[model samples]
Target: MDERDRAIIRELQANARLTNRQLAARVDLAPSSSSVRTRALEERGIITGYHAQVDLDRVGRGVQALIAFQVRPLSRDVIRSFEAFALQQREVLSVFVIGGGDDFLVHVAVPAVADMHALLMDRFSKRKEVVGFRTSLVYDHTHRWTVEPVIED
Candidate 1:
């Protein structure tokens, strides 16, 4: 992609709610041209899709924890089952199967600490694939909503 294409992507990342006309104006391109380019980007897989960042608190899930798990790597099949188990749980926001001291680092959120603990012990600990686990409560979370592409020095 060229500079203009990058600019379009950057603007979309900042505020995806912007209109086609507004995006075109911000990028200093004609409306029709901008629309065409944007559509082409979407078709070519440059722009995959758009998503909404939900307010987890409003949705009754504010608490967040980073749960690290040690898995019993007895076989590839066991590891795969562990991965599937984590994904199937509703409280698990994200799961990463990694090659490290801890086999997985799972980002989870639930209504309460009690609930989180229950999920860990009842759901996760019961699985034979899971050997051990450690959890870190997230006191606060921050996000960088906009990131500009760095030009080479």
Candidate 2:
């Protein structure tokens, strides 16, 4: 919650695997203090968890697409059903239930455009709840996030 805590989060955001000694040095705090603060952040749910970015090309799947799903009878059960089904598919990396105009936004990776088309028609089209969907092919996707804190003089 303090400046030091903010600094620790910044350094960890850059690389989660940094040693406590390194983090403490960069944040200008003692190792024990840094450890305690980091632990507190984790316990308080400020620091959720670490994750690795997966390479789609390395996995033999070069296509990344975002599919927007419009569901019929947009009830909770119908939404949950569509989300669950999407998540269970091999090509789907993540399924997000969204609000606005659509029921769900699904992230999928596939070997080719033809494979994606097949999945759309064979898998999702058969579902009774799916009213419509639109696919957008991703040429590139990059994420570089930050958690910057305001410092007062």
Give the per-residue lDDT digits (tens) of candidate 2, residues 6-59.
Answer: 889889988888999999999999999999999999999989888776677998
lDDT, each prediction: 0.86, 0.89
User: How does model 2 fare in lDDT?
Assistant: 0.89
Candidate 1: give the clashing pairs.
none
**Total residue pair clashes for candidate 1:** 0
- The sequence of per-residue lDDT tens digits that candidate 1 reaches over residues 1-153 is 788888888888788888999999999999998999899889999777787888778898899999999977657888778888899999988889777688889999899999998998788999877889999999887872445463632
By lDDT, who's the top model here?
2
**Candidate 2, run of 10 with poorest lDDT:** 144-153
**Runs with alpha carbons beyond 4 Å of true place in candidate 1:** 74-80, 144-153
Question: TM-score for all predictions?
Answer: 0.80, 0.81
Give the local distance difference test score of model 1.
0.86
For model 1, what is the alpha-carbon lDDT of residue 66? 93
Pairs clashing in candidate 2?
Answer: none
